[model samples]
Target: MTLRPISEDDIQALVDERLDTARRSEVEAYLAANPDARTRVDRLRTLGRDLRTAFAPIATEPVPAQLNLAHIVEARRRPRLQVSAWQAAAAAILLALGGLGGWGLHGTLAPAGVDALAQEASANFAVYAPDRTRPVELAASDSAELARWFSARLDRKVGVPDLRSADCRLMGGRLVATPHGPAGLLMYDDHRGTRFVVLMRPMAEPGDAPMREHRFGSATGYAWAQDGLGYSLVGAADPAVLHPLANTIRRTTATNT
Candidate 1:
């Protein structure tokens, strides 16, 4: 039987991980064959993750005083005073998704320097690794174009690192905002769908530094710097397997400059 052409709804369902097993397999095959479609799927997946991450915390926080049942009832019973448009908007927002489902994130500051790079990479991994439909902003079939777009964003020539020796296929890349600045994110996946990410950004404080291992959440990876660009390789892969792979990326990117 012939499967219908992949549509936006299909892409969304893929990101949401709601597609049936057989149709999902077909969709994955289609994404692999079409770089542009895969990119769009990745983007849609990323946007969904960003929303959930942003709002999930807010959704968990205790109801504010204004939103409390007793307070709401009391306010309603009191004489209805004229409310400014701003106050009405704020109340509406509080009663809506922005107020109940998200908006709790406000206190923690992002890590600085190389630490930030590793954090960003790990965060990106968390955001993308589980996505089977589209995990990269660009598909490997368009690596050359992805390279150009990445370099343009960084204002430096950034070459996509070859990870074939590691049995990891280039899944393409995207530009991600970082504490330092905009950075390039290159993703790779192996035969088992094991995903690894390489994050590169221009260093501000210490442009050159030795490699050091780091851990963020469940991800174990290494971060280092050369010249003025900082790099972090992050994944849930075993440390023993990642160390040498990180070294290989270092050597390859070293020559790229």
Candidate 2:
């Protein structure tokens, strides 16, 4: 008998790395045959990485004094809070499953939250990249002014990396908002009108990992945290085309810092 065809849930499980080895292999085979499904799975994985980057620090933070065991117990005695072990276990399971048991929970879980940078970046690119009339708030000719604007808003020095060698020139930038605060997006485009965005904002905590990479649907991204700032570069270009630009930006930024 034929195995049940892969469902969206299976793709999500694969993206979440929740599938067992055998199941994962099956999903991989399905993805290999279906490029569109593979892209969606990649996007989900990228969103998960961004969420973890934003929220992982909370897991390591010290409990507040008001939330200590003694204080909690005294509060419970005064105004009894009831939660069964089963309820707690179920809550834990939900968190483990990324706050839902199914893919239907995707759009419901995020709406400009701090953990949604990748999702927003991907969405923003999908929205603005193709627009010919008005893609950026500022124009490239005022490169200095644009950098100054972003630097002032971000409260950190930010710059547009020159990628002329890569045939992509600065197309200006815009200030975007995340749950934490305002973020910066420096846009660029090649002669062919292929667009890319470099998004940057402050990190929620210190000591995050130095660097990582992700793919959001048809786009590729490189995410890194350095000197209390987090940066992500997203584009629809293949990884080979994107990697050099990302590296050049990282090196240029490091030198300036």
Best by lDDT: 1
| C-alpha positional error of residue 237 in candidate 2 after TM-score superposition, expressed in Å | 1.0
What TM-score, computed on C-alpha atoms, does each candidate reach?
A: 0.57, 0.55
lDDT of 1 by residue, 77-175 (tens): 664544566578755644432221222223354356677667767777777677788788888898899889978988888888998987889988888
Query: Model 1 segments beyond 4 Å from truth?
Result: 1-109
**Clash pairs detected, candidate 2:** none
- Estimate, for each residue in 24-125, the C-alpha lDDT of model 2 and write its tens digit: 888899999999988888888889999999999998999899879998788777644345665687666446434321222353644332234555566557
Candidates' C-alpha lDDT: 0.80, 0.74
Taking every candidate in turn, the Cα RMSD to the unseen true structure, in Å, is 32.1, 29.1
lDDT (Cα) of model 2: 0.74
